[model samples]
Target: MSDIGPESAAGKRTLRRALLATRNGLTADDVRESAVALAARTLALPEVAGARTVAAYVSVGAEPGTLALLDALRARGVRVLLPALLPDNDLDWGEYAGEGSLARVRHGGRTALSEPAGERLGPDAVTGADVVLLPGLAVDGRGLRLGRGGGSYDRVLARLERAGTRPALLVLLYDGEVVAHVPGEPHDRPVDAVVTPSGTRRFR
Candidate 1:
């Protein structure tokens, strides 16, 4: 991993590269197995179990998979909201009906993403969620998350704060991504908990 800490943009970029490299090393089978375990563990969380609506994203590439959990939540009659990336990099949400309800979307030159094909719910739709699942490379003991530096979720967090919404914020990760510390900024907000394949950890 790069020697750069997580504070500076360069440092965060370095950390993100290192983390992506690590994730890239995992095989397809390994990711599937981990995804199953992650879903089981995440489903057991009280917050998730009690949530009637969840704001989450689809996993592309080697990111900890959310398909199983998303389906499970939907089966339980929970309203699942999936994000659609806007041209400006902000996210617009749509309801997740099922695997068939998602469409492959390519934003600019970036990798194609699986987004909801249903009605556009607008960005503020996230504020109505009981739980929000954030995508991250790593999270510290203090619950600070190291994202991919896209600034999309940053905007989501900011919007939630401005609306005075206090939904339970959670991140799904592999066990190895739980580090002792990560870079933090004034706009960076700490998550309420993290769910890994092994278990879930909460922070104050």
Candidate 2:
């Protein structure tokens, strides 16, 4: 395990190194297709069978097959939620329509292009969700996840844990990024499973 938070230069350097290592192995289009395919397979699993409402992250680098999976879920009458970042850097869950429904919504330094049906909800709203798909630069066999340096998911997942509800934590990563371990700290949140282009695997 390693010390966490953006305050530490060392942690940031390690994260940067890991990200470069991961990205060096993944081409843009390769990751996009893989993300979509793996997402499709993960959603088909029995764990997501009864999930009428689910929450997923918005990917920055390569658009993961998140939209495709959301559309499929919507066709099946599943309600989907995406993150709407608050001023305090916390996450607020919101409804997400397909890509066509997107509109620009701005925060401090980031602008979110969100779906039309987007409705904001507190962290508590996430507990009722059956599945929560997270994005990561890298994830390890022990379930440790390396996020994009922003602590949004960390804070939100921690809040969920405090409420005693365990949502299925799923990560989408490039196949080669999966490893034996990732540097982690007390504030770092781990995923239950990881899905890559190769396949979906439970982290133990």
Candidate 3:
């Protein structure tokens, strides 16, 4: 249990290190259990239930798993869109057919990511989604999200804003990752809600 209080005003680097260190201690079984519960909890959200299209990402390393939810969404005939990382760190969109449709792509020195193997739908394709599930290291009480600092999702949010589109923004994480506050930047965007293995919390 790390203290990520608003008082610390901890810099993004320090907060991310603490969050990532905690995640790294999780066992495979722990991740599996969290993933199962996360799917059940997230699927219950009205936004997810009503979404015609969802833009989500694959779980990598010790992050909360998302494959279960992705599969469930597809099974419900919901159009699931996954991201493919671009050289500039922005994301490209693609359809998630299933586990078989994902390809393992390694980006330089970064961890290999599981991305859609089918046709690329372009980055702007995300604006068409009813919901966008963001992968985050941690979220605070205000629903402010701490991403991997890749600027990829920041681009997505800006793109959506520029398009005058406001979709349900959500983040999935373990309970402990939900804290009192997290470092924020002018470009940082807040999430509408957060889904954890324990349950879901709406910020706005």
Candidate 4:
């Protein structure tokens, strides 16, 4: 784990803002093209290809899209799990049936999200996953991810740690979102790899 200093928080916030701004600047067509490229790269990862079960999320708006990848995984007979946000911001799990199985959900003061409209699986269901696909604003060379400040995935990571489950963690992002450094804290666990539109970067 990387050491966190007094400046880490401010630096993280600044980087988050910059990354969000850049993502917002992308046109719809640009996001679509990137999503296609990202899905191909992510699907080629050995971790994803070998996993029997994967916990992934539906990409909203400017985030690197995941609908195509989710469907592809389902067609491959991989059990795909999607997240449903809980009242406290922790995520609940559900099976991804297909594009039609998702419902548009709007949380308070947040952008609308597409979530699975299936049976609700307990949060611990993620423990059974062989690989977990995480959403993030950016990821540094060290594999520290900068999330959207929701802290939802933080709870998910904490739950996995408590259960001693060691699943391969991955983040999908645009080529530019991979950076040299990301301000990280002790609770922030590094990911095993990042799949971007251009390629994948693995961390030790």
Candidate 5:
């Protein structure tokens, strides 16, 4: 790991593994309780409170939960969008209707993902969102998110940029996953904020 976490490739992999291991150790009850708190903390964000359309996702395995947050956002009349992974690892968007509207999809040799089962909206559909909720393993003080390295959300962010849309980008994570620093590149866009179970952290 580099003395400074940012810009060090090895630092990201090392940190990501550690964070994921900690998450995998969480109990089911722990995940449930944290999800409730995360929902409350994230729902209170001014950007989310004012958003008409929010692009979000479903959490799987040990990731910080998003189902409760998704439901809460929908209850507030926000049009929530979820991603369905394509074969090439790109994403396709679909609206979140409710719990019943989700379907489990298992990619070969990968953890099954719960995605929206409704109409298949084109990928560019995310450009209409007022807020975009990202799923991540950890985030640093400067709002640099450490993702799963799947490059899916990276594509989403690039699409948003190409469309000249600058919606508030947010990541959901466990409280302890908020770290002092994270490795990143110039092309790696820092998020606007990170919502943890305890509170929210905003960055430039």
Candidate 6:
């Protein structure tokens, strides 16, 4: 195993502090607006624009922002899917048309907005996707992603890799969540892009 020591604890604390500071400095309205703007910028990316379908995760806890982005994607006539976490913490994709279109659903400690009519793509869904906006707990300059202590995304993305897919996996975060380096396990995944409040950066 990696160090998993005080540095890790300290890094997590720094991340928490950063999130708190961001929240404290910005009102709810500001965060919402910034999220919308950032979403718009993401859609402008060639990878995002060309994607026929995209899967994104619903924001939970103190995660930066995503609601407005979901709405923006829907407004643009894009097919958007949110993760439906299964009992084993495996993920299934479901369409999201907005809060109204979503039915209340939760599993594996993860809350989900589900669309019964939404098509459930196979594990190959990752390979078929034109772009994927990944969710993570933290990210670094090299695009390494630290998920919520779960190996789900890594496993899924690994499936895509074996099948030889090039879907752009992009990590979304708040402004300062992008760090110089972060502790990464061997199974941790790296994203192709990172989208922040200010802009979208191509790292892969």
lDDT, candidate 5, equals 0.90
Could you give candidate 1's per-residue lDDT for residues 111-181 as a string of tens digits? 99999998999999999999999999999888989998889999999999999999999999999999977
TM-score of 5: 0.94
Off by over 4 Å in 2: 1-12, 17-28, 106-117
Which is better, 2 or 3, measured by TM-score?
3
Q: Which residue pairs collide, candidate 5?
A: none
Candidate 2 C-alpha error for residue 177, in Å: 1.3
| Residue lDDT tens for model 6, 1-204 | 333667775665676566556656767776677678777788788877777777786665456677777777778888887766655657777677777765566554554534334566644565666778887756777777766555678777887789887788988877777777777555556788888878877776
**Pairs in clash, predicted candidate 4:** none
lDDT of 5 by residue, 77-100 (tens): 999999999999999999999999
Score each candidate by Cα lDDT: 0.92, 0.73, 0.92, 0.91, 0.90, 0.71
Off by over 4 Å in 4: 1-6
Please give me the total number of clashing residue pairs in predicted model 3: 0
lDDT of 3 by residue, 28-142 (tens): 9999999999999989999999999999999998899999999999999999999999999999999999999999999999999999999999999999999999999899987
After superposition, the stretches of candidate 3 with alpha carbons farther than 4 Å from their true spots are 1-10
Which digits, one per residue and each the tens of the lDDT, describe model 2 over residues 111-137?
A: 454534455676677787888888777
lDDT of 6 at 79: 80
TM-scores, one per candidate: 0.95, 0.84, 0.95, 0.96, 0.94, 0.80
Prediction 2 global C-alpha lDDT: 0.73
- For every model in order, what is the number of clashing pairs? 0, 0, 0, 0, 0, 0
